[model samples]
Target: MALIDCIVLALYLIGTLAVGLHYAGRNQRSQDMFAAGGQSPWWVSGLSSFMTLKSAGTFVVWGGLAYREGVVAIAITTCIGVSAILVGLFVAGQWRRTGVTTPAEFVELRFGRAAVQLYTWAMMAVRIVSTGVALYAVAVMLVALVPLEPGHPLRDPASGHLSLAFAIFLFGAIVVAYTVAGGLWAVLMTDVLQFIVLQLAVLFVIPLLWLKLGSGAPLAPLPPNFFSPTSDQYTWWFMAGWVGVHFFLIGAEWAFAQRYICVPSDTDAKKSAYLFGGLYLISPALWLTPPILFRMLQADADPEQAYILASKLVLPAGMLGLMMAAMFSATASAISGQINVFAGVLTEQFYRRVFRPGASERNLVAAGRWFALLIGAALVAVALLVPVMGGAERIVLTLTGMLFGPLMAPTIWGLLSGRIGMAAVTASAGLVFLAGLWVKFGLDGPLGSPVLAAWVQANPRIADVLVGAVLPVAILTVAHLLRRTPQPAWRALQARVDAYAPTPPDEHGVDHAPAKVVAISLGASGLLTLALLAFNRDGRGALLVFGLSMLAIAWMAWRVSRRRPGPAN
Candidate 1:
């Protein structure tokens, strides 16, 4: 790597730390710390939501998959956009209207304290593992891009585990610093900036590759099944089933839902989902194009290295540095969101509710910070151990599917329906867990049912969709109805909804500081981006496009700032 690239990376890390520290003092109260006092602009929350879903793995793994599979990959990506649209229409507004800091708190409101505690611990486990996998993905990319010296102490003989551990700790520490300091405010602001950086980097690469490929290039023939959506592994039935699975997963994804809790109004929450959906509709094409082109040009290329190879082949030195910085931004934004949400759950749902019900706001905030550190440390430890788990990414996805599969039905049912007994919810969730485990692993391993195991292995994707989502939802709905559960009166449920409504803002006092900070940060990032482009002779066209985009962003930021609502009580 060039000295200039190193400097750009350092500056980005420093700027992120500054953003976190800047908001530390202002987040004195629990609400402010956990949910940004419900004052975040819709766009900020929206971009953060988009970036949370778009992790380092999306660039490396999904791009690689797209390169290998062609249009079939695009079909999988569309599920995410469809899920976002469903969330916007059915889930986001309801979550924001609940006035809860964390989804666990909502569980408590609907179910009982015991249910909330159970849900919190379960989600904590899932989130920790998920974040660790995200860290591992980033570390893999780092080791590939920035090689260690042959004799370095942290470089292992046969593997990059030691270097991977170091990279995880280094990046994890930076994420903890800002997330703990500024909480969601810092997370959202940094995410907006990070999202911009990632978009510009990928957008810049796509056109360069297109121009190169269009200039009378002879491409190798694709694999036989490359464009087919119905391969042995991914049948049309399997793909259709996953659309259902994704709908449930999107509704139950806690980190994504946390964005709704952060915004000021239900309208903003819905708008955020819409914004995320719109981005999903377009960004995947930009992200996947370069890798696809790389595959076309280099038929025998390593699929996992598609994005990295494309950048190395096409981007100039200074531009390469910016691209690396963007990759780091993707990882940082994702891990920070996960860590912040975990901290919120630990502090609000566990510590404050269980161990220290009468604890002061200051004490709760301090606990949240400590929780952030603890989670960061755990993620680093997991990253170190991840190398032993062959196919770690697939394992993480399967684990999350099993973990959240059962809970989805009960969660949505609790929100939309009344008179759902605590017993019913608990039993339904437990049954789903058992069912998912039986289909996913128990039959294949512990149960030792060769016939069932063979069937499951033959149709794994379909099994996941059925056992993980559809069947569980159906089972839970049947149980609820068979019990003849009697819902509360409509008026009674309406009263509870009203009670959870947002507190009225102060009439005279309004804070513009957050909006100002966001505007300034966006402008600064734009300048930094321009500076990086100026250093690259081939980046003039990219610079012009970036500059115009930044101007549009600045204008939008101004309008959002002016329309910013006063602080929630």
Candidate 2:
């Protein structure tokens, strides 16, 4: 390893642990630890939320996608950006008012303790399996470049007896240490730092790639007629459908909700959403440019395979380590954030709310910590399953999108109307699962691969995008309509929940001030869209300038988070 590589990686890890320890005490109280006492700055939470939700799979997936389709990534990105803004306008108030520690907490409040337990466990299981695969993906890349514990299972066919499972464990251990040490606070702080560093690498890698291309470096050959807009990669129908699905998927569920939950107040939540979503619309380019440009420069280079090798060939030791560190942070923070959310569900809704109502608060918190460990272990065990997860590597967000799409549409509808029953919600969830399976079996089999495979060929990401968002929402809405009227108890509960809608701050100006926030937020997102357009039109110099500007804005986000007041809530 080069000195710069080691130094950057070392510094990143050090920062991660430091942030974790920094938040350790906050977690001593379960709510504060798990949910940050419901007072985190909305903007800070929004920034962290983006990083945590995006994942290491993003570069591999989005870049590969961009290389194939060009500016279409912007459409998908816009879908989520729009969805998030809707989430801010519609869903933020109810979630904030409920004063729940986690999403499962709301389940308990809306449904029952038993349902909460089941939902919590189900979410945890999916996350564990998914996170393991994500860790494994990184392991594959590492093995491709660095000789980390040689003969590692990351090598196909397993030479030298280094098990891929062990690499997952090692990585999981790193995430767990930080997660357990600092809790949400630590996760937030470090994520901002990671976002900054990762964005730097993202911007840096582009220029280097163009230089290489200009200098006649080895590269991948694009498919015949690759640049044609009529190519399957750039089909208008596919792009539109993809974006529309995410409109519900990203807008309603997943990590963006986590940000809404973290901020200090409803008004702050709105502003954060507006600001975050505004800029967020553009981040696809900031985060996605490196991989796409890398592929373009290496057009003759097998884009995916080239990226794996390019890091070793181009990035100096320190910068390589820095890039790796940024990657690890993005992945780890994501996993740990989910773990923390699951633990809160376990301790509050499942363990205490259901099984042990009389348990002391402190004991409940300890239980959450233990639950985190258990989930981490499960992830390690499932790392071996990565090879079989099938396109799980490319569709990390989609995987999660599947989980949220159905549930979120119903929840949002309920929150707005203030009358949804647990039975209806649960039924909606069932419908969601069936939709996902159908896509996996039907379309996936036909299109993903014609030959028989052990499991369905449908990538979870595609399922996440299509079946996850569309089918379930339609089914859930119909089911809700066809079902009987709300029960008296349900109405009462809804009333109680709505009673707590946090009053908007007078000075906060939910509509006006948040507009400024949205301008900044949307401006960043706009930049991404513009960059992609420029690149597609062969405006390489213009795209470079736009990217540099985003780097500045992202820096401002980091500074905002860093200087945010602790007592804002």
Candidate 3:
């Protein structure tokens, strides 16, 4: 990379660190550190959340998937777009309403101390492994693209075999340094700058790639599944799932909890969610197109490797370093956000609640920071020791599959299941989910799928999240009949949910009421879902999903329709 590009990259990263440190003292109260005094501007909070939700892994994997798997992959990207709207409608205002420092706090509030603690510890466990994954992604890419020297700890000094673990650890140190110092303020504030760099890097490269390799005639001669939804390789189930998976996993998530916390109020937060949805639409397009262009330019070339190659050998020297830095920002921002929240939840729920319920606020906050540090240190150790899959594509997918499917269960149930307690539910789900993923990734053998007894050897990180999420849903189903819920807890929560949620305030403040609002939401979801189903008949589903989503959103949003946010109770 050129000296200028290196300088720019270094300056940006250093500047991020500096800003984080700048706000280190802002945590006058424990809540401020995690949620920035609950007064972050709608725009800044919204943007930070959007960027955090979209990671380097996301950009790299999705882009690479498009190139390798064909246009059908774009449907998956579009799924994230829809998920953003769901977040706006369901998650945004309610998170703020809970009046908690972390998402796990909602568990404690809605279920009991036990559920919150269990979920928190489980989530942190997931975070440690997930962080390791993020580190691997950023580090491996750096090893391949940037100018790592032979003796560099990231690269093997002698044998030249990839020291996958060391690379992950090396990057972990960088993320923890900035994140531990700044907290959410540091993370979100730095994210604004990171978003600018990351977005521009991907955006600029796509055009250059296309310019270098013009688009050929319509890609009709490709394999049946190359881009066709109707093709065997691209079934409607998979296409439809892309929407479900990405929305829950990325867009509508507790992963970006601070974004909801930092908003001025719940109503404004809802606006941010919707607005961010629109912004999120462009990311996959930007991140995926370059590799596709590269492959078209060199038709016989290995499309899977084209993305990494272009970023490495194809871009101008300085731009390469800048791009690497942008990716680091993307990966780091996301990983640290997860780490910070996980740490906070672990402290408040497990450590403080179960072990030292009487701990002072100061002690709880201290625990949060310490836990983050310890987790960071552990991940670094894992990064230094664990062996990762050789190819980035295989490593990422296997990791995502393990986590993506199961994690959604908790969030979904949290939003929908009113009486079901989260503690036993989360614990059951967490165990089942992780075990399933472990079986899928390890015990399954060379492929790391769930079918084989050899799946025990699969990458454990991915296994944890996927199984953790999926198992909970299944367990909850049985638990619904067998496991008894606390009657008082259920009654108390229902009371809270009912009193707070209001009918949409039309131009006239009539009591639009719950029944009317429910009708609208159900109607909207049904219409769009049918439209999507109609895609087999001239792409009707493709055209109407957006309109239907918006309509369903309008109904779901009735609770937050008022601009004044009803005085925060």
Give one clash count per candidate, in the order shown. 0, 20, 29
Best by lDDT: 1
Q: Which stretches of candidate 3 lie above 4 Å from their native place?
A: 147-170, 214-234, 250-253, 299-305, 354-364, 384-408, 422-487, 494-569
Q: How does model 3 fare in lDDT?
A: 0.60
lDDT by residue (tens digit), candidate 1, 1-569? 56677677778788889999988987888888878887777788889988887766776667777778776666677667877888889988888877777877777767777887777777677767777777777766666666656788988556633476677888888888898899888888888888887887888888888887887888878877776656676677766666666656666667777888888778889999899888887777678778877887888776666777788777765666667778878878888888888788889877887799999999999999999999888877877777676545475557644556676667766667775657776776787778876776688576668987898888776677667667767776776777665544323545666877654454634555556666776677667666766567875876667756776686676776787565543
| Top TM-score model | 1
TM-score of every candidate relative to the true structure: 0.91, 0.79, 0.73
User: lDDT by residue for model 2 over 298-318, one digit each (tens)?
Assistant: 555443434444555555434
Better candidate by TM-score, 1 or 3? 1
Which run of 10 residues does model 1 get worst, by summed lDDT?
Answer: 485-494
lDDT on C-alpha atoms for all candidate structures: 0.75, 0.61, 0.60
Model 3, 66-140: lDDT tens digits are 666566566666656677778788877776665566777666666677665555655566556655656666765
Model 2's alpha-carbon lDDT is 0.61
Candidate 2: list runs displaced more than 4 Å.
Answer: 1-3, 148-163, 216-221, 224-255, 297-308, 394-403, 442-466, 483-490, 501-569
How does model 1 fare in lDDT? 0.75
